[model samples]
Target chain A: MQADYVNPIFKAANDVFNSMLQLEVSRGDLETNDNLVSTKEANISIGVTGDLNGSILFSFPEDMVLDIVEGMSGMEMKEIDTFVTSAMGELANIICGNALTTLNENNYNCDIVPPQVLIGKGQTVAMSTEQVLTINLETDIGEFDLNISIS
Target chain B: MIWKERYKIGVEEVDRQHKELFNRLNDFLQVVRSEEDMEKKAAEIEKTLNFMGEYVVVHFDSEEEIQREYNYPDYEEHRQTHERFKQEIMEFKQEFEADKCNEELVMEFSGKLLTWLIHHVAGADQKIGEYVDNN
Candidate 1:
């Protein structure tokens, strides 16, 4: 993926974290992964279509997922249940949606499908292509990964 | 309690509606997460859903009107998002009416609502505030 494409995703993640979650996020070095795998317990995959075609995967650790839900709802959650998973999926959806807007401003008209959540360990996602860009996002609650593969 | 000062978009009317939405959603979530049995919660759930369904439409309309008045460039896109959310809520209402005692559905709905409200106000709607400030 081009730096142009990746920057929007980073900006979106930073903006969403700061505004919605009220948390500061600092990004680590970007790296490439051979295949898409759930490095964390909760994974949300969002499909992008139109100007760009492929999916973005957001992998969140179990503790981070619970922390985000707790932060958003002010209620304690101990497990990765349906409610937790749904909220995680929406978080990915929001990030992708904002990225699409940024892409549009740059003349890349695109739209995103609703987010799909996968929960479990050792689950793998079949990439549409060979390489995926991965970024580690460190937030006050915890850390999560953003895997991007779009042509 | 879900309403936060940080979520304000700087547009007075829109910010007011957002707070109302958060208040309504907070009430709905409390009942959904409560330990009360579904039978006992059904009436309150139905009432909250009704208020949410109607109030969302009102809020979206008022917010969209502000966008139009300011000649917001992304008005159509913003309106489309509101339309999609309204459809989802309508579907949920229909499902709830068909099965009034489904605690699982209520739980799912509450989770989705909480996430959607936060992102919409803080992410998408904030752009509108930026535009207003710049203009």
Candidate 2:
């Protein structure tokens, strides 16, 4: 994907984290990884259709996931259960939806499907020739990765 | 308690409704997370779910009216977002009626509700505020 396409996703992530979770986020340089294996425990995959036909994968470590849920709900969560996973999926959905809005404003005209949450570690995602633009985001709660693979 | 002033979208009516929505969700979250028996928690969930079903429609209607008055460019898209959430809640209510004591479904619903509210109010609804300020 073009470098310009990545900006909207980054901006959306930053805005959501800052506004929703009240967390400031700093993103690292965007790098491409051909073989994308998620080392994090929680993965939320959001599918994009219309002008762009691919998926955006949000990978969060176990602690980061727990921290986010606790931050949003003001409760202590010790494990990645259905409640935690669903919250992560919805967060990913909101971020993707906002990014799509930005893309539409730029005349991209795309829509996002419901997010699917996968809970596990060391899961390898097969991209099948799609270039994955991975970016590491640092936050006070923890660190997470945004893997964008959209054409 | 989850309702923060930062979620205000600069519109009085919509902001009030948003706060109410957050309060209701926060109430539900509190009950769900409490150390209560399943029956007690289920009863509270049912009450909140019913209130959410009716109040959400009212809130969305008011917000949409404001969007139309401002000639908000994204009115249709924003309404669709509201509609999708309404549909999901409706489905959840149906499942809840069929199995009133399903703690798992209630937990999932609570989690999704909290996340969706925070993001929509702080992220999507903020754009409406920006548009009004700009125009």
Candidate 3:
């Protein structure tokens, strides 16, 4: 059940990144690093719940975040403020939304929350981690850490 | 995941290939994004890069061939899109070798490709699917 739920989401994320961003990405191991920390300029997170629940967080250094947003919107995203964060959040949302559809096909009825953009230092969200799986993605643009845990 | 019934765009051969293309992309991405060693992941990335460059071109060509067969109204527009992709792929190949640190370019490219394919299939190419359905 966990395999079915997470694999598709990971695949869809790769596909979206491949097609939408044109950067080839590979998954990282399900590392158990709860105290995971990043000094990257921006991190956008979205929540998943019911039957399967956790969070997908996309982290990027300042320039990388702007580059991603600029490409998606076809406009220059100069700063790591509200508008840029919202745009980045939407990309995460789209990936999760597609992943949910993939999950539904495999018999897991799950839904997702609106994506949230976290700003500044000390923005930490905890997960059950007891049975969590992290779909870490290493890409040319940056890295996306997808942590999935069943509640 | 094999191409299910839902993604069909009506044209027989092209539809078959489209499903195959999606499956290949999925497989390629899975390998690329695998939580393995960096060397292993980079190996897969290099391998899949070839597939995307060569295979995607072939796929796009075949798709265009089908469009031509049916006299697709947006043929010129579609062709231009393909041309742009081809050019960008070449540029990426060069940049990839020259600049290892510039992964941002790669990420941006992937995002654009993902969004473009969905809209192209669901919006532009779907017209052909509609035509085949109607005819």
Instruction: State the lDDT of candidate 2 residue by residue for A71-114, as single tens digits.
Output: 78778998998889888888888788888889999889899989
lDDT by residue (tens digit), candidate 3, B103-132: 444444454454445545544566778865
Tens digit per residue, CA lDDT, model 1, B39-80: 999999899878877899999999999899999999998999
Candidate whose lDDT is highest: 1
TM-score of chain A of each: 0.94, 0.92, 0.82
Regions of candidate 3 where Cα sits further than 4 Å from its true position: A35-39, B1-135
Best by DockQ: 2
Alpha-carbon DockQ of candidate 2: 0.65
| Cα lDDT, model 3, residue A41 | 57
Q: How well does candidate 1 reproduce the true complex, by DockQ?
A: 0.63
| TM-scores for the candidates | 0.86, 0.85, 0.52
Q: For residues B1-135, could you state the per-residue lDDT of candidate 2 as single tens digits?
A: 577788898988888998888777877788877778877778888887787678889999999998899999999999999999999998988998898877788888878888987878887899999998888
Candidate 3 residue lDDT tens string, A1-151:
6677667878877876775567787977666555434335577677878777776665666777778756544445457755466556656777788888888887778899977777754466666455445566788877766655544
lDDT of 1 by residue, A1-151 (tens): 3776788988988888888888888998689989887778899988888988788889899999998898898788889977888887888888888888889999898999888888875667767768988899898778888888788
Please give the RMSD of candidate 1 to the true structure. Answer: 2.6
- Looking at chain B only, the TM-scores across the models are 0.97, 0.94, 0.80
In model 1, the runs with Cα more than 4 Å from the true position are: A104-110, B65-76, B127-135
Better of 1 and 2 by lDDT: 1
